[model samples]
Target: MGLFSIKILLVLIIGYFLGSLNTSIIVGSIYGTDIRKHGSGNAGMTNTLRTLGKTAAILVIFGDILKGVLSYIIGNIIITAIPDSSTLYISGIGGMVGGIAAIAGHNWPVYFGFKGGKGILTSFSVVMMMDWKLGLILLAVFVVIVAITRFVSLGSILACAAFPIGAAIKGNGTVFILFSAILSILAIARHNGNIKRLLNGTESKIGEKKRA
Candidate 1:
């Protein structure tokens, strides 16, 4: 393969593997349990908190966030090493590709029976690395929605929905906007069950504990 192809392959492979780490699962294992079999049957930060405790949840969240940040950094580093690049736009696109790969891996981790978290935290981390301004805006939106509704899923959905709009408003390139839209769609799609429960008023609130 060519040099560019090699770089893209490396980015996707490394990013996906990093995301597939499934921090919650690893943390859960340390406690002699599988997080996916616990509360909400979801392997994520909130679920980790419900199943394990604050400490485990914090560790999982940190690991997941680092996955996104590291993927973005690794992609940019690879692209930077390549010669004959006239603009940094190529690196930006490469970083997006890597970030998307990580998000996908997080949503459906290959290491954990293809079941994983919704990718909200991972997406947020990636967006923060890509554009701090847009990241802060989305963070504000998430916090406001969660504070009012006390529904983390609602906050996540709204934040994901806002991502593409924020990118467009920030005058990001077409490729970036398109990638942001794709990420938004993926995030929302992963929360379809939560959306249904939300509409039916059966969704669990932020701090609700799952029945054993």
Candidate 2:
């Protein structure tokens, strides 16, 4: 393989390994529980909170966010090393080879019996790589929705929707727009159960007092 190809592979490896570090699994092991076995039974931040309380959940959120950032950084470095990179503006998408690798890794972490949390953290990082401003705006939407609705799923869904608007505002290329759309789809698909629960009113709202 060419040198550039080699470099790209390295980036993907970094991203995948980093992404494979599932926050929920790590925390769950610490507590002698599989996060997926208790509470709402999801492995992402929301479920982590329901299972382990605020401190553990907050740590999971940060850990997940960091993994995303790491994946983006790995991919960006790869694209930048090569000339005439189409992924320059939103090059992170191409590197999403790495990003998705990471998310996939999280979903089925090698270290955690091939099961992991939802891709919420990866989505957060991927969106940010599209554009930090866009990512921040997306984060704002999630924050607002989650803060008011107490539904992390709603915030996540809304955040995914914000990608296109942010790309348009920045006048980014069609590739970024397409990338955003795909992410929106992935985000929604991952939340299918959460959406159903939300509709059925069985989904947990953030900060709600747990019943005995």
Task: In model 2, state the lDDT of residue 187.
Answer: 68
Model 2, residue 85: distance off in Å is 8.9
TM-score of each: 0.95, 0.83
Q: Which candidate is the best by TM-score?
A: 1
Candidate 1, which segments miss by more than 4 Å at Cα? 85-89
Tens digits of lDDT, candidate 1, 82-156:
765444346486778788899999999999888999998899999998888899999999999999998999999
Positional deviation of 113 in candidate 1, in angstroms? 1.4
Spell out the clash pairs found in candidate 2.
87-91, 150-206
Per-candidate clash tally: 0, 2
The residue-level lDDT of candidate 2 at 192 comes to 84
Error of 1 at 192 (Å): 0.9
lDDT scores of the candidates, listed in order: 0.88, 0.75
lDDT, candidate 2, 8-126, per-residue tens? 67876787788889998788789888888887666788778777888898889888888877787678777676665333344455466567667777776777777677787788787
